[model samples]
Target chain A: QQQVKQSPQSLIVQKGGISIINCAYENTAFDYFPWYQQFPGKGPALLIAIRPDVSEKKEGRFTISFNKSAKQFSLHIMDSQPGDSATYFCAAESGGSNYKLTFGKGTLLTVNP
Target chain B: EAEVAQSPRYKITEKSQAVAFWCDPISGHATLYWYRQILGQGPELLVQFQDESVVDDSQLPKDRFSAERLKGVDSTLKIQPAELGDSAMYLCASSQELGQPQHFGDGTRLSIL
Candidate 1:
């Protein structure tokens, strides 16, 4: 069973537009949500993250909107640029000793110049 | 900025051959993870370690795959008699402790012929 599900396997947006990716989880135990960005031939890097306590979190041009009641979260990029084109993955982790992460299938975002 | 390190950025081997990958987590990090990412998919955890002890390895294919963190700092993952299906990217990540955000390495891309 897939613990996390992400929509839109791929997306394309014009530069200066807003790009959005959505994710949902079935495990209610998960409390921490993180988003990662990866480029071709490179490993994934942390982009932004949010907790159940907060409804949203933003860093620079990246933003993560979380809905604890719906067990969902979404990533939004404002003023998207070609440099922001990459694969994005959403992952969740529960509290306690186990820090293992459950990841979504990922979305390939392309920002047109 | 500190980052996770992985060796052998790319490897090409024939089926049934033995292959090994290495990883070094960021200094002062206490948790380490090994993940496998197939094309068009998100990374899946293969094993996790806390300090020098293994915390989780249920998803690891014990019949042909093995991993160890002998010194609790650097880790090695070995696959014997590799199969064509084993062609994927192996990623290593580390965190300061359980439940913390993880930092990832560039990963080793393995191609089985």
Candidate 2:
């Protein structure tokens, strides 16, 4: 079973529009959630993250909304720009040993100019 | 900015050939990881290391794949008698702490013919 499930394999948004991606995870032991952004021919880089203790976390234009009880989380991009176009992956990790991230399938976001 | 470094950004090899990839984690990072990502799929953990000691290799294909991190810094992954099914991206990541956000390298794109 996929530990984390992500929706809308691909998305397109006009510049300055709101772009959203959703993800759901199965393991409750996961306390840390991170979103990664990847471009073609590149490895993923951490975009933003949130803990279950917080309902939301925002860094600049990126935001992560988390729901502990539902075991779900989502990423929102405000005033999305063309530069925001890339593959976004949601991941989870429990405390300790750095077991490597349990990642989502990834969503390809395209921001129109 | 400090970043993880990986060698042989791209490799093309015939089936049953031996291939190797290398990674150098960021300085002062204590935890390291190897991941395999297939097309249209999420990255899967191949191995995890805490300093110079392996913490997990359960998902690794021991019959043909091997990995090591000597001196608690650089690492290498070797695949002997590679199969066509092995065509995928090999990614390396490191974290400053056990549960911290990981930083990734650009990854080695392996194409096993």
Candidate 3:
């Protein structure tokens, strides 16, 4: 039923600019939200994650802003670089179901240098 | 620096052929996951295992798909008489335990003609 929905199937940003992707989830049971980055021909890599208890979590230039009340979350990449060109996926996990992750379709990001 | 390992980075076979993929989780990780990712879509879990036992396989197509993890370490997923619709990327991930972060392998791309 597409528990998690992501927006802007594709994105383009200039180097050093900020890049953002948004996601919304329908299941209130979800407590853990994570973002993953995938390069072509490779697997998705864990980027950043946040729990319902935290409104925001930052790692290096990647940040995840989560709003539990709204059932929404977003990823922000500060000073996006060419190296950041890849696909990003947002996922939600509910502990009640053994932490099975439900993922959003994905957003293809391109950073032009 | 440890990572999950998957064999046969890419596989191409005709429809109705039997195909198999293998995965080896990181050391000390007890939880394993197998996911299928269609082109331009997020990965969906096909099965999950904890210590050689399946914790979930609700999304798995039991009619043609089967997976097993023996000795609580490596796992194998097999599909018999594969269909054209089965062409996709097969990803394997592992975690230390329930609720922990998962690490993914490069994945095996399967193309069924």
Cα lDDT, model 2, residue A80: 98
Q: Write the per-residue lDDT of candidate 1 for residues A1-113, one digit (tens) a residue.
A: 99999988999999999999999999998889999999999999999999899998999999999998899999999999999999999999986538789999999999999
lDDT of each residue in A11-76, candidate 2, tens digit only: 999999999999999989898999999999999999999989999999999999999999999999
Using Cα atoms, each model's DockQ against the true complex is 0.88, 0.77, 0.95
Per-residue lDDT value at A55 in model 3? 93
Estimate, for each residue in B50-113, the C-alpha lDDT of model 3 and write its tens digit: 9999999999999999999989999999999899999999999999998999899999999999
Order the numbered candidates by lDDT, best leading.
3, 1, 2
Instruction: Tell me the tens digit of each residue's lDDT in model 2 across B1-113.
Output: 99999999999999999999999999999999999999877788999999999989989999999999989999999999899999999999999978878999999999988
- TM-score for candidate 2, please give it: 0.98
lDDT of 2 at A4: 94
Output the better candidate (1/2) by DockQ: 1
Q: What is the TM-score of each candidate against the true structure?
A: 0.98, 0.98, 0.99
lDDT of 1: 0.95
Query: 1 or 3, which is superior by DockQ?
Result: 3
- What local lDDT score does residue B70 receive in model 1, on the 0 to 100 scale? 94
RMSD of each: 0.8, 1.0, 0.6
